[model samples]
Target: MAITKEEVLHVARLARLELNDAEVERFQGQLSAILEAVGKVAELDLSDVPPTSHPLEVSNAWGEDVPHTSLTQDEAFANAPERDDDHFRVPPA
Candidate 1:
C-alpha cells in the first residue's frame, strides 16, 4: 500500500521532528516502499515452520565446575582503598 505525505508529516510531528517539504515527500515514498515490502512478507505461508529465538541449533560447551583453593580474606582485601580488619568499607547509600 502507498503511504501519503500527510501520514509522513503526522509521524514527523509525533517524533518531534521538523521536516521541510522535500524531506516529507522523500519520506512518503520511502515509507510507502517499506510498507509494501512488509506487506509482501505478511502474504507468506509458513504453517509448518516453528518459531525460534536463534536461527541455528545451539548447545553448551562448558565442562562441569571443579573445586579449587581460594584466597584468604586478608589476601582478598590487601589492595583495598578503604577496609576494616575483616571487610571492605564503602560510602553509605
Candidate 2:
C-alpha cells in the first residue's frame, strides 16, 4: 500500500501542480499513510453490519396543509414608498 515518489510526482503532474523536492517527499509519506489506513480498514470483518447512508434514523417532519386567506393587493401596498399600479416600483439596476 506504500506510495512511491514517482507516483506522487505523477499525481502532482496530473493535477497541474509544481512541487519541489521537499513537497514531493512530504506528500509521498502522507499519501502512503492514508493508503495504509485504508488497507487496515479493508482487513476488518463486519459481516453482521448493514449498509446505511446515515448512522442515525432519519424522518421528515411536515406541517399541516391548511388554506388561509392572504392579504389583498391594496393592503399589501399600503406601506410602500412608491407603487406602479399593482406592482411596487424600484430604481433601475
What's the lDDT for residue 28 in model 2? Answer: 91
Q: For residues 1-93, what per-residue lDDT tens digits would candidate 1 score against the true structure?
A: 999888998999999999999999899999999999989966888687776678668767577799788999888888888888787987885
Q: After superposition, how far is residue 45 of candidate 2 from its true place, in Å?
A: 4.0
Q: Write the per-residue lDDT of candidate 2 for residues 1-93, one digit (tens) a residue.
A: 989999999999999999999999999999999999888966879788786677668667567899889999999999998899999988885
* lDDT value, candidate 1, whole model: 0.88
**Best candidate, lDDT-wise?**
2
Error of 2 at 88 (Å): 35
Work out the TM-score per prediction. Answer: 0.48, 0.47
